[model samples]
Target: MAVKTVEDLFLHELSDTYSAEKQMTRSLPQMARAAADPQLAQAFLDHLEETRGQVERIDEMVEILNLKLKRIKCAAMEGLVEEGKDLIDEIDKGPVLDVALIGAAQKVEHYEIASYTTLIALATKLGYTPVLPLLQASLAEEKATDDKLGKLGQAAAIEEAVQA
Candidate 1:
């Protein structure tokens, strides 16, 4: 791939995040089902729905970009999800597995936050003000979800899993 200028990098980040969001549409279900905590499960489910809309918004960005949907697969997420799966497999079922899964999920969220923040800055730099709001909205959603996961993890998920 050619080295992208600032604008190109922005687009690349947007598409990469686009792929990450799409991947989450699939990943969240597994996390939700794996969760023993009702709050965690519901959180995953809610994020799934938000991700669906995010995919649509990213599609709009792709159109604004006048580019096709392309993906540079995010190994970070794939690796994180895989690690969570491994932890899930090793840990006994119950709150322990749930906590482990939440930890893994939060890691994924953090990765996303970084990606979105970068892209948002790039978008603003590239003078794409219209796209900025769309990007910021998704960024905010990711942060909120992360916060919820943090709270859930601290409240019961962590303690429950550690006990197991």
Candidate 2:
């Protein structure tokens, strides 16, 4: 790993996401289990399924693009996920805890969105249209996930946190 071309970065990004998504597949269940809100728990579970699909799509895109996966460490995702897990551990049965968890989850989602957005731009500039659809699909899913969390925040206990 020396970073050189955009393609190099592209492969690195893809590999980072591959690792991050695998970690998330394992983390999501724990997140769901820790969540006191059924909706939030189910959202994590649902995203788990989506993450699995995204992982597969990444694999497909790699193959379609004829690039080898270069596993680079995703420090950003690691920190975001660690912070999320800490939120779960620190929170008790209260609206404040739920609000904190929402923020933590949103942070995770934003990280993924940012990572995927960069990859999509790289993939497009590299003329990998075949992979674009898959990346775009993942992008859309991440955006939808973010929006869902936003909606939940409006009616969620987080709203009280806002007022207070």
Best model number under lDDT:
2
Q: Taking the tens digit of each residue's C-alpha lDDT, what string does model 2 give over 47-141?
A: 99999999999989878988888867678878878987888777774566667767877887888899899998898898888888898899899
Q: Spell out the clash pairs found in candidate 1.
A: 96-161
User: What C-alpha RMSD separates each model from the true structure?
Assistant: 1.4, 1.8
Residue runs of model 2 more than 4 Å from their true location after superposition: 159-164
Query: Least accurate stretch of 10 residues (summed lDDT) in model 1?
Result: 1-10
Model 2: residue 138 alpha-carbon error in angstroms? 0.2
Model 1 per-residue lDDT at 52: 96
TM for every model, in the order presented, reads: 0.92, 0.92
* Model 1, residue 64: C-alpha shift (Å): 2.4
